[model samples]
Target: MSWITQKLPDVLFIQEGPGIRKYEYEENGYPMINVRCVQDGYIDMSSARCASMELATTKWKHFQVDEGDILYTISGTIGRSAIVKEADLPLLMNTSVVRFKSLTPDLDPKFVYYYFKTDLFIDELLGHSTGTAIKNVGPSHLKKMDISYPSLEEQKRIVAILDQAFTHIDKARALTEQNLRNVRELFESYLQQVFSLIGDRYVEEALDDACELITCGVAATPKYVDESEGVPFLSAQNVKSGKVVLDKYRHISKDLHAKLTKKNMPKKGDILYSRVGAGFGEAAVVEHEFEFSVYVSLTLIQPIEAKLDSYYLKYLLNSPQIKSLARSSITSSGVPNLNVKSVRKFLITYPALQKQKSVVRSIELMESEIGNLESIYQNKLLELDTLKKSLLQKAFSGELTKNMGEAAA
Candidate 1:
């Protein structure tokens, strides 16, 4: 059978929600589905806000989402879609989340949902979308969009094949994601075990006593320059949990670097700790003798080599216990900022220098193993996503039906 093409409005009824004001929102009433509630193929109503029953029934009655209705995000992150189930009934669509219902029996809602997942549809939608920062598409844009499908029977067959294929793909993707999580948790568990059990040989002291100097970096923003004319600058973002990342780092003029380094230079064996914003509590030891100046968001820790191992201190700072402590110490007034005084007061528990090195070696070895597993699982996830996209492309191109017929023969 050949495919028939029609405008989306001729086959489906498309409508977005009423613009609800903050005052219209309430503690209990009809659940309002927003763009955030719409995942790729399912609705996450957990974060859905509530609108008053009066508003839902009176002003927004026409916007009520029905069972089997497909919800597509029209603004911000465009083209993400989800099919509304029976359990999701009685929910009202909020702005930016448009609902689609089949206007003709020839169109299977599930088939249309799968088509939305296709790159062809998404690319067209994106092309028509407007906005530099947050892209948006109106119902009029969707109304003019083309939708192609075969007979009703063939549509159901395509949906069935896609359902089975995507089920397996999604299962594999879920397992891969869980494996990635497990690999990360393994490293965290090891860190927990190492730090939680303090032995008789362990000596507990404040970081102030164990470190030769603990100071933050320059408060003033440095004048940036070309790499050849300046030195690498470090910030909270440059410091990862266990290592420094310079791939996206900026360069500051030599004069500015020299001026900043006079008070807060990070040399070899020093620890760079992210002390503010999203990266707070993360620490990485400086293993190179290369010159760099840090931002105020980073703290420089020069550990007394005789008393504490630099790697040990770094691992400790990144440990679950210390991270929890650091979170508790964060200033409540502004952006999540960890005060330098909190770093000075941090309790450091350690054994002899040799034992500290031994612990570091063990953790590093385990980390290497976990890193390999993480890479494998991550790659598997990427592969699964590619497979899914390939299946969608084939399904929409009519090749999937042809392949299925050959298989049946």
Candidate 2:
């Protein structure tokens, strides 16, 4: 910035967006582009609202966007920017957004647009942003944002390099994301197939037939336990589909935990199923020996002697079939729920205990394979993101062009 500002033709002017009101918005009028319309380096106007012509001409006529102008979000989702195109002209903006127009021909707007995507600009914006909950930046804060550039031709060269790199990176990312989704869907389809019986060996029975007891968790809310003097308290949030997330834990005193679970202690090989709200039917096998007390939002299932394996019950509870059954039995109107009766009466089709174990083993193997692939793709995505940041740093520090020059030599 020190070097680039030294050769400036004119100080950059920053303008605030028009303070358009909700009343000024209409179903059909002059198109008004807000922050939502600015996405992925382009303006998406398919869902953009409109303002009455009278309001646009009378109050916001001066705020109309033109080709080459840069629109930046200043509140809520801060620092996202997009360069205006010819088709984007004559659109009005609200106060949540701002516009930046170069006063000199020396600076290339396209190059500047890429700069905003860099960590340098984002760090600066965060430093100047004000607000406890929702951060904001006004024109004054934007004016202080430091931006450096090389000659126009050099800027164009950098933009060209980044553009090519981004295209390749984006394509790889999309493919990886799709592959991840495919693996998940494959697991789901396999689950449905395994549960869908083909032979007479398997018989359909109520969920109660396979379990000794299906009971709800503690009805009374336990007193809040201090971190040092309490045991982990499990709730619906801790039980995810086919897994238990113990990351964010709340604790209750050992005395309270004792009284809460005096009826039945949740132990290893037990299946814990969420019975209420958004996580209804999601279940996890108790793999850990750690002491924990569950809330009323969860149900503790005690499998009968040799009828069901805990792992099989966990997977069955997570299957689409079980979820559909649970939905059908939801007696509450306001909040979704799978009550004790629903759990006891829920239908299940199963074969011998050995067959259930075989299915469980197969599912675990598939889960492990999918998990490995997911990790690989996730790590690759992280690497690509890091690569982008590195490229931006090199481009700004002249290292990119220096390497290009050396290659030419």
**Model 2 over residues 266-374: C-alpha lDDT tens digits?**
8888888888897788889888988888888989888874788888878887777887888888888988878888789888877788888888999899889988988
**RMSD for each of the candidates:** 3.6, 5.0
Task: For model 1, state the Cα shift of residue 301 in Å.
Answer: 3.0
Q: Candidate 1, residue 387: CA error in Å?
A: 1.2
Residue-level lDDT of model 1, residues 1-409, one tens digit each, is 7999999999899998888889999999899998899998888889888999998898778888889999999999998999888987778989898989999988999999999989999999999999998999989899889999999998889888888777877888888898888888888889989988757898899999999899998888877899888899889998875788877788999888888778667798899999989879999988887999888899999999998999888889989899999999998667898999989999889999999999999888988999889889988988888888887888888888746533422
What's model 2's TM-score?
0.75
